[model samples]
Target: MSKSQGYDERLAVPLRWWAQGTMLVATLWLTVVVAVPGPTAWVVTGVALALLALLLWSYGDARVVVRDGWFQAGRARIEAEYVGEVAALDAEQTRLVAGRDADARAYLLLRPYLHRAVKVEVVDPADPTPYWLVSSRHPEALADALTALPKTR
Candidate 1:
């Protein structure tokens, strides 16, 4: 929730993911130290840890926002005028929509950690994408915000 009148959510990776990544880096440090037994091992471990941090930070930086009559997920955005029906999906429904019943042309902003999602139909005649399936921790809130958008068209 920013100062703007809209919904904003950051899809940050879970703490467990960071813990697991740190453990993996620690294991690599141990293995390297055992094999090389010098400053070279320390340097290698430092590099590995830095790279892991960079990767996790970038991967978890995706954002979903509904503001100023627009819906944005990651790098894609659509005006409210072109937004159609919106639905908040539970874990089971999200699985089905993202897997079994998924459209090839649909825009997807899925995350393995987030089981729930919001499905928003694209009403624009010019767009090839049929809809957007975006993973959200608060799918219901996201759906409500999207549904409340003022469709000027």
Candidate 2:
């Protein structure tokens, strides 16, 4: 949980077909080493595999799910008991970005393919923070869902 002003946000791991393709390629590359000879092949293969795993883990986990009265983000499902407020941020609206990101930050998750996102606000005296900036695929839908959730005390 990070803090700043009067909002809090939780993120999830980003998963998409492109990323899956990368994972597949990495896996295949590692498998190819089996055809190589010598101990050096094994060593190089191990290193390559390790690097690939790290890359997958890095991008495989970058999503944000917000809930009020609860805390759920990433892989862990959070109950809606510790959440505060809901916030919607998009590049088209925020204009707080560069590149093609300007018109696409209006979805559920950020992507090179689609550029939008939403975040949960954490506004408790006990948890004083500003807001979380997240990327999303369905900006309006995510915002609507978050806003529709019942407010918490």
Candidate 3:
């Protein structure tokens, strides 16, 4: 039998972001087409399409997956043994920890659109990072999974 996943999520960009980006791209296309005209108009449309594709691709890259005794956020992954002191943060606290009172050594996988977050401490003595501040729509669930990890070296 296979072990079940503890936590798995893709942190996607908010719909409003996509809407805003599309509006911006449309405006740019209009400006280019209006100013240049003819074949240049088609070039402008192609550029707009390319820009939108790139934006979506980049924004969809971040993910939080907790499985196989590992915590993966964005492009970084660490073993559960090194994880400690998971704190679920509300919008206000998330903002404070992620911004003003943030630790420089900590790893951050933050998305501006995500207001809730979880802070996971790194207990590895050799590692300079204090904790990871990660944006999560389900902070409590993520925290619970982190807390459930067995303490080990």
As a whole number from 0 to 100, the lDDT of residue 3 in candidate 3 is: 26
List clashing residue pairs in candidate 1. Answer: none
Better of 1 and 2 by lDDT: 1
The best candidate in terms of TM-score? 1
Q: Write the per-residue lDDT of candidate 3 for residues 1-153, one digit (tens) a residue.
A: 112558887898777778887888788888887899889877878888787878786887789988878999999999989998999999999989988999999999998888999999998898999999999989998888877765566
lDDT (Cα, tens digit) per residue for candidate 1, span 1-153: 433478999999999999999999999999999999999999999999999999999888999999999999999999999999999999999999999999999999999999999999999999999999999999988988898888898
Candidates sorted by lDDT, best first: 1, 3, 2
The candidate maximizing lDDT is: 1
Q: Residue 91's C-alpha lDDT in candidate 1? A: 97
> Cα deviation in Å at residue 139, candidate 3?
0.5
Better of 1 and 3 by TM-score: 1
lDDT of 3 at 54: 86
Off by over 4 Å in 3: 1-4
- Residue-pair clashes per prediction, in order, are 0, 47, 0
> Which is the winner by TM-score between candidate 2 and candidate 3?
3
What do the candidate models score in CA lDDT, each in turn? 0.94, 0.50, 0.86
- How well is each residue in 1-153 modelled by candidate 2, as lDDT tens digits? 212111233333445654775676667656665677567666766676677667656765655554443343444343443344655666664446433433332222344544565555545445434344456666565566555555544
lDDT of 1 at 55: 92
